[model samples]
Target: MILCSSTPHSSPETQPSGLYSWPNVFHVPKFTYEAEFELQQRNIEFETNGTYFNPGPKLKGNLLDGLAQEMMKYTNYPKDYQCEEVAAALTRAHPCLGQLGSKTGFWGWKQSLKYKMQNYRTKLRRLGHPEIRVNSLKHKREGQGKAAANIKKARKAEVNYIPLHPKGETIESLENERIALLSEVKKRDNEVLIKAKMENTFYLRRLEIVEQRPMIGEFKNRWPALFEESEVNAEFLRITTKPLQSKFMSQFDQFSDKLIHILKKKGGVKGQRIKNVLAIKDLCDDIDTRRECILKSVAIYLNEDPDSFFKEYLASATEDAERDISSTVMGIYIIRIDRNREPEDVGVVIEGLKVLKNVGSIILGFIMLFGLIYALDLSFPENFKYTFKFCQKIVMNLDGHKLNTKIQQLKIKLFA
Candidate 1:
């Protein structure tokens, strides 16, 4: 159930079994994993929401991160999420605590990805393409479409629903075609966007009357007939020759339509000062549905520490390699799981093998075709090597909760 905000305030999505009074308790062991997965989902929502408050300077990297996390932590939040002493210290350290400057241009690539994808979606919506969506031109559309269909199918299957594939056809071919369509759309959209970016830069110059004055004034002095003429494009050139106008491409609709009218009427208007820019959360929306599968994967691995022959499970694999490994893992793992097979029965295993007979003969054959990369080899980049080390450190710290006290002290000192 969705807890929508629009109605007469819908309740939270989970209707408690209400057998016992403890609302925090998980009725199913897997439900606890869902709670952890919510951490990432909530973080995405909170980040988008934070863009609502203020896009200020002066807020430390860690402080901004903390505020985002805290906002997600409590549905209702206190003013000073930091303790009294720490809050006092922070203010004393930077006397003008609430003061801020312009939006710090989006930072870290890790953080940049969420916002960039949001920006991409917003630009599309502004261009009146709200009905359709695509990530980027870099992928194949038919392939993405097919994968999306299969993912939807699998999710439905999780709800105890099974799909009947087309007569004499397999799900695999459908997945590939769907993926190809999505990729094609993504490429076409981006090709158009590049042109829009260049056009936006030229359009922005019309914002400043004084800056535009010199160019329009020169035209009036020289070819007054042309400046006075009804040709809109010619007059627009005079308006946009100004050197000081800023390129704020996000407001292209208002900018373009207004410019066309002004050019036609030989009139001008001043640019308005912006008070807010609402956070766009489209990328976050796409990932929201995937949270269920991610949580399931996390839960299965958390307790069991899954075993397998190949050692390239999760060792900071390169993205290019990760793609191949992910496919190989998907194909192999699904084959291994044999979900339809009952315990103490090999019949389903035989049936599945029979169905898969013409596909890659063995796991090793599939891995070889995919060109599996040894994740721990010297070929791994330094950053990925460090990432593995960092994960190891975190795991070590998790094994000792006392390490959290040290972490707390480090955070306090860093914030101070």
Candidate 2:
């Protein structure tokens, strides 16, 4: 009668698209097959304790059924079948078995499953849907297209007993194991610790995005900011995104540090020793394409957002009148108000007009056209095309050269 559940909780991970990852959020080590085997071994070591799982029948992968057979290996399941009491014990023992080995910790699989289900239900209720239970695979699409809405309503009106979902249990166990392994590795690996902490940081930002715009309009406005931030959030991204440049940098630093350490230990390495060091140095140089990548990124980012930021130095302040945003500002404007697109895209306006009266570009003609297009889209004061062309008529002495396909592609993809 004892029904054990084998659900363990998992930690959350932030997805790239800014979704919250709510995983199986708990741990239960004792319900695993290994834990049962250990418990059986422990009972024999204690001499007086009754036998544990595996003597009577083999497991069928179902934790509850397995626990039933495990109990009956030496004891009678019918006699021992007290679901509630046994479930409570499994709940208490599962965590300990995970921390200390199963032999010292002790829990039955059947009871563990039930306890896990109870814990899962408790968590789901905490998430605000008390009536909504984990959906079992067999029952997932159930009652959807059925003409039994009234029956479903009646079931809801009465006390309904929802079956525990096997997948949910599996998810929970997997989560617990993954987080436990991560925690164990963290003690020995700096990289794992860095990744774990970075994951938390990323999740916090994702939650912030959810708060700002759960709706489409808000998301459209806010998504750009998230995209921009993701570029520089952590070192792994920085190094990889910057590509072979960072790899070479790391290799160089490591080799230099090693060489210095070796030299300090012994004054100098000559002949064969020098050759070994040179080989390492050459290996280090092989990963050095990072500088070229850095130059390209610098050219692009600094060109587009000239006043924003650079890896070398803090970006020049927008207030610095002498700063050159001619290319960047024009690029922003062209993108936002090209071919009768809205002048009312306030982000583009702010970015374009950030420097106000100082746009010195060969494409200043394009800027005039851009403002006119925005005006036409907004029905502002005048016809933008006519006004700009008329102004061109008076000043530049040019007949007709407007933003065409080649210009559009260039302006949007790369800052001219």
**Among all candidates shown, the one with the greatest lDDT:** 2
Clash count in backbone of candidate 2: 20
lDDT of 2 at 89: 46
Encode model 1's per-residue lDDT on 169-232: one tens digit a residue.
3345544443343343336335344333223322122212112233333322322222111212
Off by over 4 Å in 1: 1-177, 182-406
Alpha-carbon TM-score of each model against the true structure: 0.14, 0.21
lDDT of every predicted structure (CA atoms): 0.25, 0.30
Assess candidate 1 and give its TM-score to the true structure: 0.14
Residue-by-residue lDDT tens digits, candidate 2, 4-67:
4454422222111101111112122244566466655654554554323342233324445433
State the displacement of the C-alpha of residue 174, model 2, in Å, after optimal TM-score superposition.
Answer: 33
lDDT of 2: 0.30
